[model samples]
Target chain A: MRTLKFLLRKEFRQIFRDKSILAMIFIMPTVQLIIMPLAANYEVKNIQLAVVDRDHSSYSQQLIAKIGASGYFRIVADPRSFRDALRLVEGNRADLVMEIPAGFERNLVREGAQNLALSVDAINGTKAGLGAAYLTRIIGDFNTDVRLEWVEPGRFNPMATIEVTSLNWFNPRAEYRFFMVPAILVLLLTLVGGFLSALNIVREKEIGTIEQINVSPIRKWQFILGKMIPFWVLGLIVFTIGLTIARVVYGIIPAGSLLTLYVFAAVYLVALLGFGLLISTFSDTQIQAMFVAFFFIMIFILMSGLFTSIDSMPVWARTIAYLTPVTHFIEVMRMIVLKGSGLADVSRQLLYEGLFAVVLNGWAILNYRKTT
Target chain B: MPLWAKTGKTMGAVTVTNLTKTYEKGSVTALDDVSFRVEAGELFGLIGPDGAGKSTLFRILTTLLTADRGTAGVDGFDVVKDYRKIRNTVGYMPGRFSLYQDLTVEENLNFFATLFGTTIRENYHLVKDIYEQIEPFKDRRAGKLSGGMKQKLALCCALIHKPTVLFLDEPTTGVDVVSRREFWTMLNRLKEQGITILVSTPYMDEAVLCERIALIQTGRILSIDTPDAIVRGYPDRLFAARTDDLPRALADLRANPSVRSTYAFGEYLHLAFRQNDTENVSGLSRYLAEKGHSGIEIKPVTPTIEDRFIDLMTRETTPS
Candidate 1:
């Protein structure tokens, strides 16, 4: 125990002595937290539209006006010919083109139905998909207006309809920042905890100080813990800074208990830092340790369900997602931050993090040999 | 207890029995059937050039590495089975400066002191003479220290715990002359405290400082003896000569039938004979003059450890 105390003191002095570490601890969280949420947003808007109106009828003009008034699409081209409108789409200046056939009002009044052609650029899938959906809904509303005018206008339309009145359960306003803030918080902790600790021991190995340490009577566990505890505390500090940025900048407050969040975070840091230690033990240089950590963290982030739904991944990927600790932390973070979950609600995730902590640390300590 | 408890080899502060190690799947033999022993409280030296397996031997005995097919012990503890016990009782200063460069001198010393589970005040007397030279700049970071001061600080850290045996690998390889002298003086003081010291160096000049030195080359011990004894064991009478053209004189001497071995040592060319015949001495001056040499001066000279080592190595590599 006395050896461990000395080790901690030495570790902390080294950590603070490095100016880069302090900058990373404070600056990284604030910058990534504020920027990632705004940049990674999924809300698609301001889609460019090109129109080809052969009829030039009042109904065609009215439909175009309604689409523009919706503020979702911008009319970038109003070509007289359909070929010119397609040219605009091909040139990438237009995202979608809407075409109205000749005699469209007459056909609609005489035949009680008309055909309208819509073409969307499928290159950017999300932007194209959302743009097409909005346009279709607006045209349907226009069709309803034409029918209601022929029947008894403004008198309930003589047709039965059901109103949706959708209620987004967790995020009532469906704010993207609320959903992203918690996920980003978990990611920051993983980076600072994983990369810093991974590089720490490997630095000693490169500089030959590890041989000095190894030749002494210091126990293996004492050395490993000495490398761990300081980084673990720094990880928590990074987490707190991320949370503060979330609350102050994004106006996001965790709906769950702070105590539960901290408990899970503390355990997760142990697991993550142990994993970093495991990599350092296998590597002889800082570059090798970094590449190994980077490769895993990339996989962890992409499969953590932070940006995509885990339910949508293939069976093999989903299994990996469940195996990684990041997925569980992200899930529990969302559950607590948005759903007001308690300890009982997140008990299973806490157990998984605890299990990871033991297995990873156990392997690190076992792999660390005083004699080789 | 029997001195050789397990291996039954010669027992001392450190012992190795036919130790062998190979790297890259037995392709490069670092230490091959090599063995040596250092008596208790004796200042021993393993003198060789770089790549002569000096550092490898240090590591194996310190328990930082293991050998393929031999047994080694330090302070009666087996390096392999009782590694932890051995680690507690020995101090090692690797060839490289291994202390924390980011830390101040005092902090680095205190940290190592704490690692051995002892306070500085406990082992102050052991490291005082060496530590005092570096203590004036204790607040300075280790990375910023001069080469000599850096070495002194490394020595203090290694000795902070007061181990029974100390291993230093080339402690004066890169130091200035004045500091190198001071370092040897400090080691002399350390030996007086009854701590067995085993030091390795590439410089043959440093061998004379050791009570006994094992002259090693290519993972083999060429000879092991006291400096004076090894010098006295030279097989042939040696002579030194200085000519206006030294390299030409060396070539001429090497080609002569009477000159057994010749090489340039400093400003003079040293020669050894195939037989203990002083009659050739006067004949050699006339022979060199006939080979277009001028201002030639020749005289009989005593051989240093270096001369004996070079002759031994040349004989070892050449077929007898």
Candidate 2:
């Protein structure tokens, strides 16, 4: 306990000593949390499109009006030829191009067939796909309108339609920011938690202070535990502050118990701190520790499913994903904040995270040597 | 039993038998079957130069490393088996200034004290002398302190726990002359307080301050004795000689058959006669004067610790 007290004091002093580190811990998170969620929107809106309306009939004009009224696309230009529409897309002036055949309305009226072509930029594949889906939905609605006008008011429909009623569980609004904010919070915590502890030990090694500790009457466990506790507490404090910003600024209140989130976060902090300790053990310099921590953090954040869905990942990748502590915490944070999942819903994730904490910390302690 | 109680004997004495440590595992032997003992309260010095294995030996003795083949006891506790006990009994200051740079001097001292399951107030006297020197900068970050101040802080931290034995490995290497003198003075005061000190240095002049010293080189002990005794045991008659042209004079003496070994001392050439017979010096002086060496002066002088060290090393490798 005395060792823990000393370590905590030392860690706090170190954190407070470097002004840039203080800024990274307190100020950067707030800025990133607030701006990232608002900017990183997956739901695309106001897609700019050019239309080549070769069929100048009232029916074709009406179809264009229907596309414009859908509010998903802005008809930025009405080009006279298909080539002009293509140029609009190639020149980056438009995201999509819609081409109407010369006799589209006449073919629809006489032969019950018409064609509309949409060319979308597939470089941002997901955005392109969403744009195509929105355009298709508008066209389908127009077809329904034409069919309704031709048939009697109470006529029986002969086609079978499958309706997909998607009930977005946690975040009913499907706010991507709400999902990203919590994950970013976790990333910040891990980065600081692991990096700071790693720096603590590596700094000692660099400055030659480690030799003083090594020759002292202190036990190996005391020394390591003393070094770890302060950072762990600081990480928890940062975690709390992040959650507060989510609640107060973004109005994102977790559906699950905040107590449960804190508990899980506490365990996760241990795992990260242990990881840092492990890095420090192998590293002889602060630069080496920073680089090693950076490498692991990149892998952890990528595999954590912060920006992507883990469910969509392949089975082997999913298995590897489970090995990362961040993965479990990100899932738990999302479930609690978006889905309003109770402890019972996230108990399995908590268990895995806790186990990771124990195993990693145990391994760190085992590998840490009193003598070099 | 309390953890400290269980390892109480570690503070009693340290003993090593046939201790050997090889760096690069057979490529270089840092400590080759080196064995020595430091009785309680004795200030033992390991005198050697760079690559002489002083730091390596200090590390092994302090329980910061394991020996390849050897048994070492610190205060009646085995170095490996009773490492915890030994740890509690010894304070080590490595050659480098290694305290937490981000932390203030007081914080460094407090942290070290707390780690040892003690408090600074409980053992203030042990570190009080050195601490007083650095007290003015107690609030200053260790990184911002001068090299000498950093050295003092390191010593204070090492002494904060009041261990029975202190192992300082080249503690004064980079320190200024004044700081070096001040540090040695502190060590003397600590010694008077009955704390055994094991200090290593490459400086031959510092050997005089040690109770006894082991002159080591290339992982071998050339000689071990009191500084005076080591100097007294130097066998050959030694002389310091200089002329108008010192370099030419040195060359002339080296060329003379009567001169066995000659090396440049501070202001003169420290030369040894090939034949220790008192008759050889006159012939060598007459020969130098005849060889166009003017203003030549030669006087027999008592050998210093460094002089004896060179002579011992030379004799060790000579075919005879």
Candidate 3:
């Protein structure tokens, strides 16, 4: 224990001695946390729409007004013909074009039906799909309004209208930042724990200091723990700073106990740092270690169910997702912070993280050879 | 209890028999059928040029490497079996300076001390003679220290644990002459403290400082004896000659039927004669003068370790 303590002290001294690394450790994560949520936002807004009105009628005008007032669409073009409206989309002035056929209002009043041709720019498939869906919803509401106005409201009811009032329980506003901030917090912690410890021993190898340790009587476990524990503690500190940013800037407070969150974070960091040490043992250079850590962290972040739901993934990918520590930690973070889950709610995730900590740390200790 | 348990006796500090190591699928042999021993409290040197397997031998004795075909031990513990015990009992300074460059000198020293399960105060006396020289700049990072200072810091760190056996692989390869002399002086002091020291150097001048030296080349031990004894073992008469033109003198001497071999050695040329040759000084002077050489002088010089080393290497590579 005493040996480990001194080793930890040396590691901390080295880490704190470099001014640039100190800045990178604390400042870079804060900036990334603040900017990534804003840039990676999924809520699509201000869709550009072009309208071609051939029927100079009030009904057609009213439909255009309604689309504009829905707050989702912007009327960027008012073309006199369908050809011009199509040109608007081709020129990138608008994302969608709506063409009302000739006498469209007269036909709708006389026959109670009219055809409206709509074309959307599908170059950016996601924006086009979502904009089209929103337009369809607005048109459906207009259609029902026209029907209710033409007939007596009490007798014209389409067989017992059912109202669907959707309520998002955890995030009522469906704010993307709430979900993203927590996941980014997990990524920040993983980056610190994984890359720093991965490069620790390899740096020793590069500088030739590893021979001094290898010749000593220090146990392999003691040496590994000594090399890793300082980074583990730094990871936790970074985690706390991330949480503070989440609470102070994003107003995200955990529903469960902070103690439970810290407990899981502590165990998760041990597993992460252990995995880093394992990479260090295998790599002889810092560049090799960095590349290997990057490969694993990339996979962990992508398949971690952070941005996409793990259940929606294929069975093979889902199985692989379960093996990544990021997946479980992100799940726990969202559950406790957004759902206000308790110990019982996160017991399964906690168990998995605990097991990972034991297995990975054990593997690192066993793989670390004092002799070649 | 054994002497190692009570007095930290390093009797038979290192022993290797038929030790062989091959790399790249048994194609390049590093150590081939090598055997040697060092008595307790003796300063031993493994002398060889680069790629002579000196570092390999040190690594094996330090338990950092394994031998493929032979057995070795350090301080009565088998290198392969009782590696942990050997690690605790030996201090190794590799060919490269292995101290943490980013760490402060004091921090590096303290770290090694703590790793050996002791503190700076506990082993201060052991490394004090060396560490005190660099103590004023103890707060400076090792990377910023001068070459000589770095050498001292590495030596101090290696000696911090007070092990029974000390292994230094080329401790003074790149060091200046004054620092190299100071380093050997320090080693002589450590030897008086009853620690068996095994040091390897490519510099032949350093070999004379070791009580028993093993001259090695091409993964083979050419000769293992005291420096004086190895010098005495050179059978052929050695001669040093100077001429107005060195290269011409060397070339013409090599062409002579009486001269066995000749090499240009800085200010003069050294010549070796075959044991059965009857060439004398006057005959050699006459030959060099006839070859358009002037200011010729020839004399018998005492053979140094380097001369013996060159002699042994030539004999080994002479396709016998």
Alpha-carbon local distance difference test for all models: 0.91, 0.85, 0.88
lDDT of 2: 0.85
Candidate 2 per-residue lDDT, tens place, B1-320, comes to: 22333443454355656778887867889888776667789888889889988888888878889989877777787888878887887898888777787788888888888878889999998888888888998999898999899889988888888888898989899889999999999999999999999999999989999998999988878887888899899988899888888889888888887788998999899999877787777777789889988888889999999999888888877856
Flag clash pairs in model 1.
none
- Model 3 alpha-carbon miss at residue A41, Å: 0.4
Measured by TM-score, how close is model 1 to the native structure? 0.92
lDDT of 3 by residue, A1-372 (tens): 888888888888889987876886899779988999988877667889999888879888899999999998999988998888888888898999988888988898889898998899999887899999999989989998888788875785557877899998899989999999989999988988998888878999988888888889888877887887888888988988999988888999887789888988888898898889888988999999999999999999999998888999999999999999999999999988898888888899989988888888788778888777
lDDT of 3 at B50: 99
Q: Please give the TM-score for the first chain of candidate 3.
A: 0.92
- Most accurate candidate by lDDT: 1
Query: What does candidate 3 score on TM?
Result: 0.88
Fnat of each prediction? 0.88, 0.96, 0.91
List, residue by residue over B69-131, the lDDT tens digit for candidate 3: 887878888899999999888989898988888888998888888888888898788898999
Which residue pairs come into collision in candidate 3? none
Q: TM-score, chain B only, every model?
A: 0.96, 0.93, 0.94
How does candidate 2 fare on TM-score?
A: 0.86
- The candidate 3 chain A region of ten consecutive residues with least summed lDDT is A152-161
